[model samples]
Target chain A: MDRKNIKGFLEFVYDFYKSMKAHEITLVYEGEITHQITKAFTSLTESNMAKEEESNSVQKKVFHVMVECLQNISKHADSFGSDDFLFAGRGIFMVSRGDLEYHVTTGNVIENSKIEELSKILDHINSLDKEGLKQLYKTQMREGRLSEKGGAGLGFIDIARKTGRKLEYHFLPIDEDTHFFVLTSTISRNE
Target chain B: METIKIMGTDDTPTVILDAQNEIFEISGRSLPEDVTAFYDPILQWLDEYSSSPNPKTIFTFKLVYFNTASSKLLLDILMKLEQLHEAGNNVVVHWYYPEDDEDMQEAGEEYADIVDVPFEQIGYTLS
Candidate 1:
């Protein structure tokens, strides 16, 4: 291989390893986000989190957020047309443990047309305080109809409620018709 | 009516609806991949029980965790119980949460506020 290509590959590996060590990342999965994969990810996370000396409440919060994040990938990830990637839904999921918090992050591809709706939802969620989020969650639960995919449209709201933190998200343009979406939520170690 | 008992799975909750014993309980995690398919049977059982509910029906929810999709079905279940209670049957809901989980407790209160059914909030430490 060319010297530049070799250098780039080595740099990618080095950066990945550095980040894993620096962030204390417990788990990382980057592949098709199928139902089976989600289950396996969760079970693995449950065992890993159990190993840590954390309260049951904190463990539950992290687990719940992780589940929602993985489900989002499975439900929304758009298929890439390349034959090399034949998975049903492709995404990246990771969990990192900080000194006083746990962070869950996920990324997936979505149609560009969905960007506006998703941006609005995230903006609304970011605007709300804890009480506002709770109220909105209840209202959505009582009045909102389930989506065609069977989601109650309360995933983001529930995440906000559970974490009591603003959701960090971004949409990067991938093509004229598609964009990559990334979302992150954090759970504090303290009650 | 016949008892509707469903064993819990890694992704779904355990459900026991015994009309004879007057015990209705759903406990454990509930985030099934196919929420509609998972909850359809329970809803049908509730529909059947509505016709001839017991004198006093106490429905208990001891869910450790549930997804957003499952939340919709939970509301449907609570609404059904509300209808049953309004029809002059004595129906009450007991929502149990981990002692420190204010989120679940608030969820119970939200459901109680939306539905006319009486709800009792119970907090217990998980063993």
Candidate 2:
């Protein structure tokens, strides 16, 4: 609240933004993931990619993955238990372009109780080959029931199949009862 | 029955089902937030169309992008068309993709693989 403290905080924020820019992140959004936000984000991202002269195919893949990631946060993000001031469904999402691939990253706080199930699912998906993932996607599509949140339990598998890459995920414990879940998926420019 | 026509939006596809003209088409992006709400009427229309389909029902898909939820509904629509075909109706699906988009072509192929109906993969450039 004091002048020197405010200066230090401003410098910290500047440093964070600088680091993100250095990584070639074209977009960085951190806040509540509302439906309006999702719609606007995808539209902005598509136009941004178009200006970059990315191929149509790659842009489609990036947009699809972005939708899934943003929706995942909106539907499943948990409130931080002790941090009551933080809004529910708050999450961080970013899209960065690398030399050969575009990386989509998202982070949200989740209940610690959900970590085991989430980890198991991620591990199972990561263990599959491309063919295996395709098979899984088809089978799930045919038989999986839609969740109350409208997910068909196929979002992750579809992402894996589209990217043809292992999904990278991590769970960082924020407290005894909550953890922040981060997911990263890459779409190869050559593909 | 009257034709069913729904205009496309940012998150929903344009649907044109004309029994009298024997033409059916779906175009644009389909990542609707409420997949069930957006697709229920289309499914119901298909059910009604199956009872009295045209001699040759040509279904065309020119989708730029769709999400996982829409993917499920798409398969459902295709399966309905397959049923119509199985019941001795002439059904053909024309799937169009941008010339540079191999992924869309592959998506059409995947749908073609799953159903017994005839499929045509068409690629065109946007001018």
Candidate 3:
């Protein structure tokens, strides 16, 4: 290995580590978001949060959103190419702790055609207050049919209701038929 | 009717639906990946129990946390119990939560609002 190239790579690694420490990124994973992965991640976060002496409500809120986001990726992520079929269910999940708050962010590949419907659901959720979100949640549960993936379309709404804020998201174009979707939800450290 | 007793795990709740022994409750956290598969048998058992349900039935939900997927199935469970109540069986749903976890109580209240059954909210300190 070239000494100069190795030095440059080490510098980059050092910068990344510092950035992660600055943000208090406690957990991060980037790979196929399978059911087993979701279980393990949430369990790990639960104990970690407990170790930090976080309040019960804050831990639950973060835990709940993490599950929804992780499962959201597993249920909805799509493959980028035939050669990378495993990437079909791949995504990135991270948890960062800041003063008085914690944030859970997830990113996954989604079909461009599916963007409109998903955005509509998110936008509708954004327009609602806590009471309205609760109504939407109950109505969806009572009347909406579960998708083949076994979701009653309650993930986004539930997250919104729990967080009591609009979902922060972005859809970056990747190709003519696919885009990368990122979602972040914030929870206060104290109730 | 045979009782259904499934032990809890890290991701699923402990379910005990015993009629002969007069103990019926589901407790613990729930975020099962295939929520339908986990709940199908419980719904089906409630269906069977509906046919010859005891005269007085008390179903307790001691869930600490559940995901949106499990939330949907929860309504199905409550609806099943409502059916039993409608069929002239006296039914009461005892909803338990950690004293500090009011969200679980609110969850129970939402289900109570949606379904027409007597629901009693009980809170216990976390152990």
TM-score of each: 0.92, 0.92, 0.95
Cα lDDT tens digits, model 3, A109-173, are: 99988899989999999999989998999999999888998777899998998888789999999
Candidate achieving the largest lDDT: 3
As a whole number from 0 to 100, the lDDT of residue A53 in candidate 1 is: 66
Angstrom error at residue A77, model 3: 1.2
Tens digits of lDDT, candidate 2, B1-127: 9788999998899999888877699999998878898888888999998997877888999998888888888888999999999999989999999888777887788888888899999999988
Candidate 1 scores an iRMS of 1.1
Query: After TM-score superposition, what is the CA distance of residue A164 in candidate 3 from its true location, in Å?
Result: 1.1
Best by DockQ: 3
Regions of candidate 3 where Cα sits further than 4 Å from its true position: A1-5, A83-86
Interface RMSD of each: 1.1, 1.2, 0.8
Cα-based RMSD of candidate 2: 2.1
What lDDT does candidate 1 reach at residue B35? 93
Angstrom error at residue B54, model 3? 0.8
Candidate 2 per-residue lDDT over residues A34-146, each given as its tens digit: 87898998899889889989887788889889999998988789886454575677899999998899999999999888899999999999999988887787778777877
Return the lDDT, model 3, position B127.
64
Candidate 2 or 3, higher lDDT? Answer: 3
Model 1 over residues A1-191: C-alpha lDDT tens digits? Answer: 69999999999999999989898898888987776887887888788778876787788888789878887887778776667855546799989888889999998888888889999999999999988997898889889988777777788988898898999999888888788899989999997
